[model samples]
Target: MDENCDYIFKGYTPNFTLQEDDIRAIQALYGGKPSKSFSSPLSNSIETYQAVSKQMAPSVKSSNKNSALCLDPQFDAIITIDDDTYIFKGI
Candidate 1:
């Protein structure tokens, strides 16, 4: 475990190290820009930050995927194009 990490995301960590897509995923994950300062010494440049920020836009994911401990709870509504209603139980 990296002690210097502000947020340790182990979800995408390869379990058996045999996932063929691991390399691509690792690249995408680490290549992402860090806006805020991390505990580590890695300097996150503004360009990297912007690129990663673009991929992590709130509009990318639906409201149902919001975690319970969501730091930002303002995303409570989403417009439906087909008028189909779907109830989302609290995650």
Candidate 2:
């Protein structure tokens, strides 16, 4: 992660339970401008973060595609949206 960066960039994708296109459709409905610090979400600038959910062992799969996972959480905050940008104000 960039230590100097105040905001992290990520795509709001499905939890792997739904089709990718469905997630994209939902995102489009909530469209807003990109933050000043980052490019629009539609840009290739969006990122994904992953972590090893299980310990590595002899029988366990160590390959990233098998062990890495990305979890999504719900957050509550005040959001300011304009035609081109959206900012989150959280406590």
Candidate 3:
């Protein structure tokens, strides 16, 4: 078992002994490609975030559009200030 291999998915802990096919299938069902650094905790978080963020972008965009300031819905917009921050106004 790889000492650095640490991942949690769907409420189940990952088995470090997982085969290549298992990893591929998991990636297909979820949304990440296997990486050599998959064994690293930081890499795992980054990959998980990337995968989930892609899945969330559409819905978040739509919600932002519909939830903008009512008086200036056309003018209001969601602004990404940075990776960790955003500016949005709601009615």
lDDT to native, each model: 0.51, 0.44, 0.54
Return the clash pairs for model 3, or none: none
Q: Candidate 2 — which residues are off by over 4 angstroms?
A: 1-16, 32-91
| lDDT (tens digit, per residue) of candidate 3 on 26-71 | 8899979555544666777877776775565544334455543432
State model 3's lDDT: 0.54
How many steric clashes between backbone atoms does each model show?
0, 2, 0
1 against 2, candidate with superior TM-score: 1
TM-score order, best first, reads: 3, 1, 2
The C-alpha local distance difference test score for the whole of candidate 1 amounts to 0.51
lDDT of 2 by residue, 20-91 (tens): 776677778986445677655744422322123122224645767533222222233334556554533223
In candidate 3, where is summed lDDT lowest over 10 consecutive residues? Answer: 68-77
Using all chains and alpha carbons, the TM-scores for the candidates as numbered come to 0.18, 0.17, 0.23
Off by over 4 Å in 1: 1-18, 22-87
What digit string (tens of lDDT, one per residue) describes model 1 on residues 47-79? 566667566655644566544334332343444
Model 2 vs. true fold: TM:
0.17
Each prediction's RMSD to truth: 14.7, 17.1, 17.0
lDDT of 3 at 41: 63
